[model samples]
Target: MSFNESVLGKEYLKYCNLKEIALNTKTLDLSNISWFFPTCLLPLGIFIKEHKEIHVIPPIDIEVAKYFNIIMKDKIDSVKRSYIPIVEILPNKKLIEKNLDSLISNKDYNMGSLNAFAYFIGELITNIYEHSKFSTAYIIAQRYNQKNFTEIGIIDNGISIPGSYEIKGFNFSDIKALEEAIQGLSTKYNDNEYSERGYGLRTSLNLLTEGFEAKCLIVSRGVGLIANKNNRFFYKMKEKDIFNGTLISTRFDNNIREVNVYAYIDT
Candidate 1:
């Protein structure tokens, strides 16, 4: 069980069961419910006071599905249903800006961490706009804790990153392409705009160490997957089609314990 898995699992067990009980109760306590809801429990919290039955949508783990079903089983026939806990569904361009706003607004993130997040988000959105030509992209942002830890995901239905690279004249497989991308190599962009070549991908990875402690999971075209943390790197995706385009998730320290957001700028 990884850190997030443990956190989410605990939340699933607590909240799913609570929603079953809270549905029938006339008045529900918001603070008490926060225990189970955690930061990840969003829009679902909207129905905490009124809904009697809660059904969590699928595309989640089987264990979570089983327990979620168990909680809703007896609560069936209830007149109350709520939307998914997701905050907002965003397109590619807006998602990056929105995440930057979030990173800036939250007081828990420092400028360095916030900047790192901003750059990472920039790279991701750029990848989407630059690669996924099939459809508009969709991104979801969720805050999971007060400790400066947040999860942001950008999803697209277009071909995966590796596929995009192949289309761009790269014959390499997923792992090969991903490695190149993370290490600062580029199929299209220069390695370093300032240093004479492509550097966005590599620069972002390097920033993980210099500025703060962070972890990133990148699934791109020919690049199957990779993650970097504490100066050590690991492979997370192996011959798996996470999706077309890429899904980049990162957790970083916000640099500051408090951020006004309005004052934080890229300049």
Candidate 2:
């Protein structure tokens, strides 16, 4: 299959992804684009006054797609689709924790949610690090004031959900494989203890959505998790085969002020 077809799908779904967002939004009369390092404010002020949209998609491979999603979700009007690159996402706990500290800081998220966010990020990153071998990986985080929530997405261009299932010695043709992966029963690792004892994804799903409107999606495997919504883990692959990589996304309301991470501090 062609890269794009294998990567996304042959149908091209809707162009409302990241590529279009990056190019088109910049043309709008009210667009404000900013870059870090030097932190130029003059350009931001001019764009804000004259443009209709503002986006902050880092140059990193994975951030492109996530940046598009964040801007589109926050867009007040119509948004065009775009194609964004996926990056290598490592699973090291230290790297993951550092990323959380840098991206999802205290200024935006609350205490408990931040803690949960760190946990979820760590788990997802760990999964990516341990399972896939992609060269690029990134996590995109954005706050939605209208929805009173924050969305975080981790994308990688490694093994997909179905591929992950296949590696576990299960038959890919079996529809039950999807269910197994979604229910957290698949051979996530070669060792049973590592997969079973690993509470990253499981605990993340439980804590992030506890008594709140939270959702998680593993696009690499065509599986999704949603609480109090259309909560079902289904496959969305076009080919009868597996997926290109994975995208673990989660969203939670903004009711917390700080995160308690004593349990995971050592990790």
Candidate 3:
């Protein structure tokens, strides 16, 4: 079957469906893809990298193919022995820290902002190991000079937010699960008890909006949340397709200077 999305709608059910089938099938065809959002590309790349049995047919759209190549270059190179790009496979904390240092050092970003970025990355990655049961994760970052913004993406294939909450005896739709998640709640804490254990996503989003005037998108299961300085919106997917994991993408301005790193950590 051919899969294509022109705008790559706010909901990610389509990609989720494709990922599920691709994981089970011997060879997954991808030659029909025409357009895709960065949100979809991140998880798709992770899926392709982890599953060795799946062979993908390159996208027909030239631009889409280029993006697939950029994000999946490291994985592709492993099999084809070609030049790889900047994508990093995050297997441990030391490598994550090292990659962030290299990325920050390459630019002239302010020290405070750099520190906050490091903190954010650490918190997000820690959450994966502490809460998410997935064994593999990927990190990709890009500094867009012309757009005056930098984007950092973390992708993991694991239990979704709703799945985690469900395990704790709480019932929430995917969208509601994300809403509660970013509010500093977690399945790790009992339903009746108040705890500060799962503040990673909330604190990170707060730092991005409050400290750096940035934006963020978090998707898991069939829902997604988008937050920026002006507004926050949530989308609940109607489609049956689902991505059984999480993707965190944040955008920060290149010239950001003042940031409240302590505030995020303390809160």
Candidate 4:
């Protein structure tokens, strides 16, 4: 609920601390601590959701305790939180795509741009699979049934943003990679129907910050970028920071009433 740079910075520090503790105990839990930013929950969720050897406790807010599986439905039912385990996508990709296509809130978005949200989500997932060279990847989400708010997070244990750029023969510092990504500079040679290679992340960032008037956070390697409704800036993390892979998290408020996805995504 209290999500901002100051609060997120503290949570990031907490994430780093927990990462160190994870090495020793192999036990991670953050259910009790109220979140500063919903994205802060992703790193822990992605790591423990896969490794069964790691002991964990379920949280009421987000079901970090449950083993993640591809959700054919969007609602966060009592059975499980909305999530798609990275491993679940490969063997059943066709079926998973069908489910994801229907998973977005059909009622929340305007009909004209309804598919845009799903397209963005699918594009990011596709990028991770085709590019990340990830041993582990995950998508975790939380919805406050009481409020008009929902948050989704995607993360991976693959090459960070700079590494992705390097893989494409583009050498950039971590910050530069992130900056270019926000500027819609993709490492892919192929282009999507709507835009060039980098449409997914850049467009999503615009949709969240510009369209929805909300905040979006992207952390890659040790660098973090915080994009808010009016302003965007980068936060350089300390060398000892934990979690090297890219982390992206954002929220959608159904109460916003008007969101122009096309305004941000060039068709």
Best by TM-score: 4
lDDT of 4 by residue, 125-210 (tens): 87777667776555655555566676667777788888888887877878888898878887877444323757677878877777
**Candidate 1 stretches greater than 4 Å from native:** 1-103, 134-136, 146-148, 189-197, 221-226, 230-242, 253-267
Cα-based lDDT for every prediction: 0.44, 0.45, 0.68, 0.62
Q: Write the per-residue lDDT of candidate 3 for residues 1-267, one digit (tens) a residue.
A: 111221223424456767767766766667887765555667777777778678888888886677678776644221111111244646565656655555445435677777887787778877887677775667666565666776677778878787888888888888888889888786775667756767888888888878888767777778866777777778775454555688877767778876869976644
Model 2 sits at a Cα RMSD from the real structure of 11.6
- Worst lDDT run of 10 residues, candidate 1, spans 76-85
Candidate order, lDDT descending: 3, 4, 2, 1
Give per-residue CA lDDT, model 2, range 1-267, as digits (tens). 232332122112221132234345664222222221100111122223334455543434443333333333322211212111122244444644443555545455456765666566666776667666655556655455665665555666666656766786767643455455545663555544535524455555555554334655444544322332334444444443232566555555666445455443324
Per-candidate Cα RMSD to the true structure, in Å, reads 11.3, 11.6, 5.6, 5.1
Query: How does each model score on TM-score?
Result: 0.52, 0.56, 0.74, 0.75
Each model's backbone clash number: 30, 30, 0, 0
Q: Residue 131, candidate 4: how far off, in angstroms?
A: 1.9
Candidate 4 wrongly placed segments (more than 4 Å)? 1-13, 29-38, 49-92, 105-113, 190-195
